[model samples]
Target: MDSMGKYIRGYVRIRLESPAPERFFSLCVHNRIPLRNLTQEGSCYEMELSARDFLRLGRFRRKTNARIHILRKNGLPFFLHRAQKRKAFFLGILLGLVLLAICSFRIWDIQIAGNRYYTTPVLLETLSEWEISCGMAKRNVDCQKLMQKIRQTFPGIVWVSARLEGTCLIIDIKENDEIPQETPVKEDTRSCWDLTAPWDGTVVSIITRAGMPLVKPGDLCKKGDILVSGAVAILDNDSQIQRYEYVRSDADIVIETRFPYYDEFSRTITVKSYPGEQKTYPFFTLFGTDISWYHTPKNTSEIYRTERQLTLTPSFYLPVTVGEIITIPYEKKSYCYTPEEALELSQKHLQNFLKNLVSENAVILSRYIQIKLTANRCRSQGYITIQIPGSDKSAVTPKEFPDLSAETTE
Candidate 1:
């Protein structure tokens, strides 16, 4: 406690010179003046004491006839006193502290969580339109109103919450699971749907869950051909076919298909090389506005890139940022590649093109490639035969069953 008081109020080291130094020490002890690190040098005494106690020692020094001189002064009190002489420095520090305190009340960061189908940027944009973005005052944010607005904006969101955690505003959301609606069937009316082929391919496998299969494995089917029927024949007690009961058809079908791709590349490529001359522009960004602190370059053809560094608090809170824009001039040059280089580049391009077609359930069965080289260009054509799941109900159409009673009577 005493050390802390000394640090706050300040302390001074003093040298007391007197012919009767022992009497001076006795007077300090009798007067209850706190002294530390006391040392004697001939007839002089040196020690340190708090600034407040040093002021009160004047009366004791008069009685002991000791001349006291301060050797050093330390702590916050002295430092502040020195800073008081420089008005600009003092006001700048005061202004910075005031700005920091004010900025602490505003939202410096925004975070989103619990989102799957909805993207974070989409949610943030919605929140921004609702006046709940970074740099906005925290007191102005109405969590309940924001939640209601979010729910109204995205109907799929089942639950949402917006709250402030320190300088960051966190928005959490939950989305409703998507469930497919089943088609209804009535006893009086018979409604059936046909599962048609999506493309011209040979069927590799089929699994029917609620339908009668019309196409089997190894069967060649054309596009829009029915692969399954939802109509089922109903039997009576006399072993005769009665009315037809219709249902929604469900099935999983796999098909083998061939995909072809073609690409062409030139042997010569154009590349840009940087020159030596460069210019930099420094700027300070507050909120979303940039205040330039340096002159901007006038060269429009120069390539430029921006780098930003944020000024943050000790705890990693960002309220303002500093940025630099560096501009460099470059010259474009063309370089011709050898045949081997062109072949390698074309091979890499072909591999990348084929990689984009691969899926988690797709299996490659066969691949064929044909490369042709001209004087200045190379052309490559390739095709891959892959087996993939091809269950598509887009071509399905509902059909009404014909009345069997009328036909039997005829």
Candidate 2:
């Protein structure tokens, strides 16, 4: 048998003191008593055997006239004998298991995956709207229904998968990145809108697809000035105003403009330096209750870093979060950035600002920034000329645009 099998079946270590221990072994062989790890000292012999065989050794003691004593007893029976007195400890363990079992059937956490455009809070709000939330029974959550309901609620969500994983509801989503073609266009006269200039800039390019273009290339338009008119005037045979038709303004207009950029920061800052002193401690959180063995001093300044969670399953995380945290002690010191360093940092910030503009489909033409460094401050002020989308849709007022029916037409 293996070690666990021997331990589970119970074993005993025997010490035999006899003039001729060879006689006891010969007798054990004859009677079929297996001995493990047999070792001999000067006069006494030690060996291990099953607890049952130990009981049958009373006859062999008489036949060989050898002394037999149980030096140690090991196994499940012995452990149970010692643990019978600690009933409360065992009861607490059983209670904990029961609690975990009960909690497994109820969701305690929600995990969202494969979402980019839709935020976690937005998806969670949709789930909450459908009466799905943490602490609800897992059985009540139909995965198929959840997938269907989510797909129906968010038209942009092309695919969805919902599953219960170890007291957690995991939802994976795939959003439709392409423009929806099946979307119904709003033809409601009361909801007529116009594309107006969102910024004061000169138009660089204009393409009118579903509305009458009011501004062409090289034309200057101020903020709120209509760049595309939704109210297309219908002229009569004599070129007189008859009536007007309203539409949802749709067009693409790029405008060239200058954006003011200003950033100022102190050269002197407080920085933390680690002195290579860190202590790690294992921690466990059970249903919001945290237990840890390590504690930091009251006057200590340190950083606490938590590692990944420890769990029975590799990817599945339970309500009980187990992990290790390292406490790193550090010292805060005053540091000053040199002029060269400050200038480099300011340029980096400026680069990030221009990068964001590029991400929004804006083309940077030229940047004229003036950097000034004083006793303790670094400042950069300038304007960047760029071509960017300049049109914003707004509901057109009847008084503003001639989209409404003529009073005499009624």
Candidate 3:
């Protein structure tokens, strides 16, 4: 619009008080000078005129004996003049615009989704190998090439989609299962098997489902002894053995096993004395350079310090970060544990050991222990008895029992 053009060049509102106001107005119109919002205020005339048009008013004012005074000013020229006066502010605005342009054209973040078999770091490493990394120019990246590279590198990744979104490289992936699923094999279809004892243990209970029980409850079974047999003798109507049949041995056999435990630790202990106060220091980073007010002390052992970093995004962290460090001062002290204290500590350790065994499906039945505490060492020795279900199966085919061909009366 013409109004916009007038504002861009700058405009001013002026008042006219002249002996021949009609002659001044006629000269402006005849000269093709634009005047806007012309109004009469008693003995004076007011109007808006372009800054350039106002320049031509000097000659008209002299000829007509009129006085011109500016009442108000607006437009782009006035703004530029003000900006020029504050050099640092104007420079900062220019730098901000340049940074925005650079960031928009460069990649600052990368996102990957729908991946299970392949880890994020692994994919990123592959991208780095192909010259695709953060801060690269957007135009330098070939999305189709990247997709092909990913698919070739990992056969498990069946499909890949790569694209650019803003300053981030977004990758969507569809991965095939690392291990193929197969039909479940039936237990009875396996060759004849016999459940054997892996170590010496007393049988607490035995429940046979598909085999003959070789050992009963409260019987001692040594290592390599068959607890359940896969061979069963078939009988005729007269209760005489006719032939032998073999089956897949299966049973739930509980055994009570003894495990010796011995643990030792230093009696000397560490203690901490705190001042009950803390100090915090804040810091800021700009363009990878950090500006902080924190100072490190010579005796860092007496100080416990930690820091929390502030990030712009949850996944993609920028270099420009603001954070604070908190430090607490404390003193360390060492002392030896008493006999009673050592006993209590050793008891706690035993309970933890039992918990670990329980986590592995072993039931803690009972334990017997003795504690020995000295000036520099604490020792606990004991034997733990636990109940564990036996699962070890060994083949006991007909070849192993060729001598048992003699038939017996059932």
Q: Top lDDT: which candidate number?
A: 2
Q: Estimate the TM-score of every prediction.
A: 0.73, 0.57, 0.67
What C-alpha lDDT does candidate 2 achieve relative to the native structure?
Answer: 0.85
C-alpha RMSD by candidate, in order: 4.9, 8.0, 6.1
Question: How many residue pairs clash in each candidate at the backbone level?
Answer: 0, 0, 0
Task: Please give the lDDT score at residue 237 for candidate 2.
Answer: 91
Question: How do the candidates rank by TM-score, highest first?
Answer: 1, 3, 2
For model 1, residues 139-205, the per-residue Cα lDDT tens digits are 9988888889889989999999887776777788889987968866563323546677876778999
Candidate 3 — which pairs collide? none
Please list the C-alpha lDDT of all candidates, in the order they appear. Answer: 0.78, 0.85, 0.82
**Number of the candidate with higher lDDT, 2 or 3:** 2
Task: Write out the backbone clash pairs for model 2.
Answer: none
Tens-digit lDDT track of model 3 for 182-202 = 876554425678889976889
| Candidate 1: C-alpha lDDT | 0.78
- Give the winner by TM-score: 1
* Cα TM-score of candidate 3: 0.67
Off by over 4 Å in 3: 1-74, 87-92, 174-179, 182-193, 230-248, 269-335, 338-341, 360-363, 395-410
